[model samples]
Target: MPKVTEAYRRKKQLEIAHAAKKVFETKGYTDTSMNDIMLEANIARGTLYSYFDSIEQVFLEVLAIVDNHSFTFIEEVCNMKFVDQLNTLIYKEVVDLLRQPSLVQARAEYFFSLEDTTFFEQRHKRVIEGITNFLQQGVESGEFAPQKDVRSIAHFMLSFVDGLMLNTSQLGETSNFVYDQLEVFHSSLYYLLGVEN
Candidate 1:
């Protein structure tokens, strides 16, 4: 048998994960099954299991991809002005959620119904830490007021984005009115951060 290189393994795993994401998004976490993913991936059952032990693991991989993508997007915007970072984050989130409501709904289902809360907690913690670090840097640089509680602000921002995404998922395709509301809501957050809008 040919030796499977590490890069090849990772590529196969990502391919399976991408297919699993489509299945989960269409059928949701509860309704999705390993067989469904196998079919979606066009891989045999053994091949699928060789990559992921179970459907939940595949779902987690998909979540990780989404998280990594979001974090990278935020990180890239870190060099921008503080207000620009906040606005860009908010706008990107709304636009992404609107473009991929299925993924957002799958994430909501995972958060609300998954048996293991550890994953959810850890993901949120990392997001909070990232936001806190960014805000702290901004404070040190005099881009933001020093009086704000970085941790609290991070928590609130996460909650705000989650709530907005959850609502947008439930409402299906977002309307202009919803976008308007998000603008107003983001303005309030900007005010809370002492960013002159």
Candidate 2:
């Protein structure tokens, strides 16, 4: 038998997670099962378990993919001009959420519908910390004046995003609505940060 390298293993795991994302998006969390993911991934139960112990674990990995991408973009933007960084943050965080495909929204809604929020709560906390760091950097660089606590501002921004997600998920694929919401969020953030036009 050929030996599997760590890179190969990680690639296979990501493939499984991608398949599970499709299943969860289509069938939803409550309706999706290990069997569904197995069928989607074309893997045996043992093979699936070798990668993920449970469907929730797979879902968490899927969420991590999206969050990681966003965070990476935010990190890049942190090095840009302050106004550009601020605009990109709204674009990535707010507009992107609104523009996500309906199936992706369905997957997000599944997690929101769940009573246990520990998974999402932790993710939200991490996001807040990252946003706080970015805002602090802006304040230190004279892009933003020292005003309210950066942590508090981060929390508020996160709350706005959470509300936008809930609202957009319900609206489905309405581009106009998404743009309108994006404008509102952009304006709100610019004003909150006291950025000059």
Candidate 3:
């Protein structure tokens, strides 16, 4: 295939992924059929099959698209020379999650349903490891306050992120964090990390 034609193929695949995301979100993964995606993408059956042989293939790709840069974002930010800077990066990440709300929650829903499968289970484990490593380094460097079990704090931080994502997604409204609400979360986190108020 010509170079230009090959590029178009990649672009078309991404478009298909976006279409699949909408269908999967509206109709739940188990209820979504390949034909639903074909209709949503407005492509012929053969064309859809050319891109993805199975609905699961398309579902996985959609998951990939949604989570494309999140882990990389965390890893790159964690490499900052200062652990404090890394926390700043994490704070921004949490804020972005707050702003979009649904993006992360949708991903979580898809992930839990797929957990029994090796592919999903391995990816989840990898995420936990990546997060744990970052938190461990932060504690060692005094960026985060150490609990006897820093690992629990790390897990809770991730769970907090997940909980907030689910709430925001379920609300499906603008982030409602008021000035007082923001202050409470910030104050609690500061106390947890031993940062001066």
Q: Name the top lDDT candidate.
A: 1
Off by over 4 Å in 2: 1-3, 102-117, 173-176
Q: Rate the local accuracy (lDDT) of all candidates.
A: 0.80, 0.77, 0.69
Clashes of 1: 0
Q: Predictions ranked by TM-score, top down?
A: 1, 2, 3
The superposed Cα distance between candidate 3 and the true structure at residue 126, in angstroms, equals 1.5
Compute the lDDT of residue 97 as modeled in candidate 1.
63
Write the residue-wise lDDT of candidate 2 on 1-197 in tens digits.
99899999999999998888788767777688999999999999999999899877888888888778777887776659877887776776566666654345545656668798887778878889888988888888888764477798889887877777767666654833766777887776667777766
The pairs that clash in candidate 3 are none
Pairs that collide in candidate 2 are none
Instruction: Write the residue-wise lDDT of candidate 3 on 43-135 in tens digits.
Output: 999999988989778988887875656667765666574455545644676666566424454455566777477887776666677667876
Which of candidates 2 and 3 is the stronger one according to lDDT?
Answer: 2
Candidate 3 residue-wise lDDT at 157? 63
